[model samples]
Target: MTLKDFLKPDKQANLEVFSVSPRLIPVNKSINFNLYINSSAREGVDRFVCIWKAGKAIQENDVSEIAKKFGHIYIAENQRNHFFKDLGDNKNLATKEKVEILKNAALDHLDQLFHNTDDMIQSESIKKCLVECEAAAIGLMESIRNYDLFGLHDLIAELDFHDHYTLDHSINTGLYNMMLFREINPNATNEQLKIAGLSGMFHDIGKIKLPNSIINATQDLEPEEYIKIKQHPIWGRDLLQQEGIKFQRNHLNIIKNVVYEHHENYDGSGYPNGLKAEEINIFARMTSISDFFDAITTKRSYHTPLEPLDALGVIENTCGIKVDPYLFERFKRKILKDEKLDSALYLPKDFDPCCPHTALDLMYEDEIQKSELNENDQEDVIHYHWAKKTQLPKIS
Candidate 1:
């Protein structure tokens, strides 16, 4: 008999037979939803199987006789669908709202996978997290494909502030890489974008293996400590290599290259193998630009955070030395354009005419000359110098 031959019409056919409860599904390998089928009708069981099959929802064909008898289908819920529905009014959400929803979902998934876990650096835990990371990356690319560059800029800026620097940094890197990837290759496919996002998110996974003291140290790291920290790329690459068994060959290659080569500089000055220019994978080069931008702009225990433009300026100076010059130019333009839009929308209408403090302000001669200025007075001097330099033109 054919698969459709099992259907038997009944009164319960019109009733709710197949249902999944607790709609929100966590990103994990475990079963997240309860599938129920009315025991009163055999048609309900057959109907459920047919619908699921038509949707191509179920990957495995083999089924237990007991489950088939009761019309129960056990399966992992689609993480992307669960995320979209949980954001509310998924059917009519605006593009911007969709982007926000996807961003939050990615962040939440990473937080659960990394923050709550014990010893995130463990090989088993890293492997599990990488699987979820790929899912989040795919979702991010889907949302980004429908979102404009301006909307993405706003979304990244809005979500940029987070207590967990590692997670936030990873998300931003992935996002920025996606944006840059689209610009570089306008015809890029969804799979390519997914690979780009995944590379950015997992680029720093090796850092988890480092000691907390080194990772979170407030003071300048000693040369010995710095040397230890430098091993993260090696650690990250090896970890991914071991975990690559589960991923397809293409995906494994992308993940491994990104983790291993992101730190390598354009001028052969970076760590690990110190590959130069085109020697490094293009995705790794893209990730490096995003990684450096996010790292300098975000607050850390060791140093004060630079403003976005100032951070860009720092990156600008190192173009061709630390990052790919051609790609950096594209990235710089994209960021500057977004910064202008952000300032227009968010800055107060009656904003002060004075310039804001920047990384350069710290080295202003006037501020440096102050002998015994109080902390407040010192700030005043820095701001005064900055305002006088140029009447705060919108960063172009």
Candidate 2:
């Protein structure tokens, strides 16, 4: 189903909002709602609880004990003293406070992860990072509902993965994917936005399992190595299941489809599952286009990335074979308007091509000569330059 269809509020849908504590429940039973200690204001509902296929309310015997476990009322103002500045007048109190609280919580969580040891991945930090990411995903959707596209875009810049470019790439893709969603449907509700954001952020998390050498490799991968690389989606899917994050069919399906088919081709030439055309999950199709576009446009080891417009050309050339034609058409005209596309293609005047960190590590004469050619004497900068057609190397 399209995003709009998925988010249509079911007033008739019987979802119970318990006035008591929500605790761990088996996945086979009632859906456990994990209340955010901070920021929960939807129609004055501070706690979000969802279970697949709503069932009867809990018995009175369980209510009193649940209430005892979650004693005392939690207020947003109380949560803010530890996080932000003044409340700034009380207008739109619920929505505004929710934004502040969730954003701060997300930031705080990310900060803890960032400061953790290099072995942070092995610790609970990665899972906490994912939790924070989930919260930010929800908060971001609410932000989109109440703000402009540009304001939402700025919030994305704040969610930077400065520690690892790969992590940054995942979050940015999720953010951009949500941005595109907003652009397509200005009236998109919070839940749909949340799912899209979460799916986007965790799309390539399987790469965490691959060897750092393969992930950080600057050269072309060998055939066997490439095969090993392709196994990440399954690895990631299994890893996520092992973590015991209760995900419904829709959420799990979207996540799995994105992880597995984001590399698939519309012309039936893609990997893992070679289903083509309308057979591809709509969400996966959308993400695949975004993933490929961003991968080619963003800087990577094997190649100096193309500008966005050049990337657009590549998309145009590959559509029907590499991308869904209809989706590409909308993406080009609706999302990347001609003027904005031109602006996106513009490189900063002082942009550098060579990564000094990588260049400085070179030990060979040829490597030093190559680095010297890329270096700017006046600015001491190593700028990336476009190579001529004859200089292009073929992938083996």
Candidate 3:
């Protein structure tokens, strides 16, 4: 490997490396693991340069000085286990640091389990990963209860994502699920948050049964193909049940429920069950919100990503129809408060991407949205235009 590969963090390779929140470090404490500061080389590659050696007593002034320059600190892969133990043992690790640790570790586990492995992940491997993820989820919940999760994304490290759509999207959905629940119900129990994270991560596991031709298809699918695609939820629910029995994990039931019902709409328009509002599971409702948000915002060979505000407008249009209205309102508040957006964003008056559920019309609209004709837009017309919908192939 090149020296740059060793120093610089790449989403594909350096997922082994985890980040530290500088703000979470207790001033004047002697940390067991070494800490590195982020540095950009002349060639524009990021380098993690070790600024503090292991077992050194960090001075308050020095800690503050480091925090001024870098919001994140780096821990090499070798120190990952030690760093996690430190976090578990220490009482001072707050919401921000726990988030950093949780995301970093999640990428590692998911990459190992689901990265190109179609021959069914082994049960032992699955258990080990779940046990680890469960621990991190509990710690994150404790921190959430203690310090609160406001201004969270800013304090956490820059996340490194997988190139594969499911891998990267799963991470975003999982995080969004946790954040949405916290915003909607700040009194969530530890078990509830743990379920939230795992359920979101594995929500689309049903799609693994589908062929790659369907998943990566740039053009529209045939009628038969679309019918086959819609059965992933059923397949996923069955798989989750089998694993739950074989592995004896009682909590997998909730995850299975979400897996089966994530696509069900609030207005009873979705498939598998067509269950309406209040009839759907709460976590599944939350998953739909995250699924809609992340699906529209991710760029693919077939679709371009949407801006945050524009995407928010699209979601607003579907608040009661496609998603739970109450949860959507809370999610909107959470996003606005977290992003600190003061000004309104422009959107198309007639644009709604979710209807007809056909690929050509939706894809055409995606291109149109990017065209010059739509100069300034303010979509979802609360009073302006009657913005209705858009729903792309929900990537597995």
Q: Which candidate number maximizes lDDT?
A: 3
TM-score pick, better of 1 and 3:
1
| Candidates by lDDT, descending order | 3, 1, 2
- For model 3, where is the 10-residue window of minimal lDDT? 352-361
For candidate 1, write residues 100-187 as lDDT tens digits: 5555656676666455436434555555566666666665675566444445555676653556667677887887788778876778
On residues 1-396, what C-alpha lDDT tens digit does candidate 3 reach at each position? 222222233332242345766655545667777777667545655666676766766765666666676667777766654565456445665445466666666667765765535577565666656655555555454444432223333232234445566756666666667777877777876567768877777777666667767655666667797777778789778766654334435677788889899888777768689998878888998988777767666555566666556666666656556777677766667556766432233333322222112221232344444553454442323322122332321222
lDDT of each: 0.57, 0.49, 0.61
**Lowest lDDT 10-residue stretch of candidate 2:** 384-393
For each candidate, what TM-score against the reference?
0.62, 0.53, 0.60
**What is the per-residue lDDT of model 2 for residues 84-104, given as tens digits with 9 covering 90 to 100?**
211222133343444444454
TM-score winner, 2 or 3: 3
Off by over 4 Å in 3: 1-104, 115-121, 136-158, 243-250, 334-396
**Candidate 3 lDDT score at position 96:** 51
Q: How many clashes (backbone N, Cα, C below 3 Å) per candidate?
A: 0, 3, 11
Relative to the unseen true structure, what is the Cα RMSD of model 1? 11.3
